[model samples]
Target: MEVRRATVDDIDVMAHVLATVAEEGTLGTEPPVDLEVRGQRFRELIEGQGPSAMWVLEDGGRVLGNASVSETRTSGVLTLGMAILAEARGRGGGRRLLEAILEHARSQGAHKVELEAWTDNARAIALYVSTGFEVEGLRRNHYRRRDGSLRSTLLMAVLLDTSEPEPA
Candidate 1:
């Protein structure tokens, strides 16, 4: 598998990947993903219309997943999100995409990278932990799912700013 920076041309496939992953309920987004809207949003990201960067994972020239990082409301902090088609999981695709996002974060002078994952998502949590992310907190029953049921998420973050603080 190959991980590379995304372009506008990748929006469709990226949307498809997102929708496919969403169907499994592993991701925050629910099924029935609106591809057109997602395509537009991805187009904006790929066009550099925001303080964000996106990357795609491909195998045999077909996109199998995507990862993205966007500047958070807090300066120097970036919010992270990623998804891989179920078929692509456990093949190092998630790791490669994560490596790309982390490298981008450091290069962009980010201080922290943060993400939220379902509390039950052990595989995802393990991946994050092995990659230097730590559980910061848990949001109890934070999300109301489409089924009218509530679910919790674990907040995780990795600090990238290891420099000494300035003198007071």
Candidate 2:
């Protein structure tokens, strides 16, 4: 699989991957919406020259996953978001996507990259931990599922600038 910066042309397939995962009631907290709506939102992100970078994993002509990191106003801290197609989950696509995003964030001078995962998502949590993230805290009942049940979230982060140790 090849990983590269995402462009507007990738919006359609990216939306499909996100919608599929959202419909599966995993990862994302956003409710599934029309594909065109999702594509439009993705277009805004691609066109906006904001403090964010998005990448897509593709093999042949198919999109396998999407990953992004956006800088927060809290200087030096960037938030990460990623989603992989169910069929591509265990094939190292997620890890490669995350590694690429982390490198992009580091290149942009970010000192830390943070992300949240539903507490019940063991596979994702394992991926994050294995990829160098540490659970910083738990956000109690922060996410509501499609079924109307609330789920807790795990606040995790990876310090990019390893020259200095994270504050205790």
State, as a TM-score between 0 and 1, how close model 1 is to the true structure. Answer: 0.94
lDDT of each: 0.92, 0.83
After superposing candidate 1 on the true structure, give the runs of residues whose Cα lies further than 4 Å from its correct spot.
Answer: 49-51, 164-168
Work out candidate 1's RMSD over C-alphas: 2.1
Clashing pairs in 2: none
Q: Which residue pairs collide in model 1, if any?
A: none
Residue-level lDDT tens digits of model 2 in 1-168: 888989988998888888888876676646566898878767766676655877899989789999877765668898888888888779888889888978877787888899888888999999999999999999998766667888888999998888976599
In candidate 1 the C-alpha lDDT for residue 53 amounts to 89
Q: In angstroms, how far off is 147's CA in candidate 2?
A: 2.7
State every prediction's TM-score relative to the real structure. 0.94, 0.89
- The best candidate by TM-score is 1
Residue 84 shift from truth in candidate 1, angstroms: 0.6
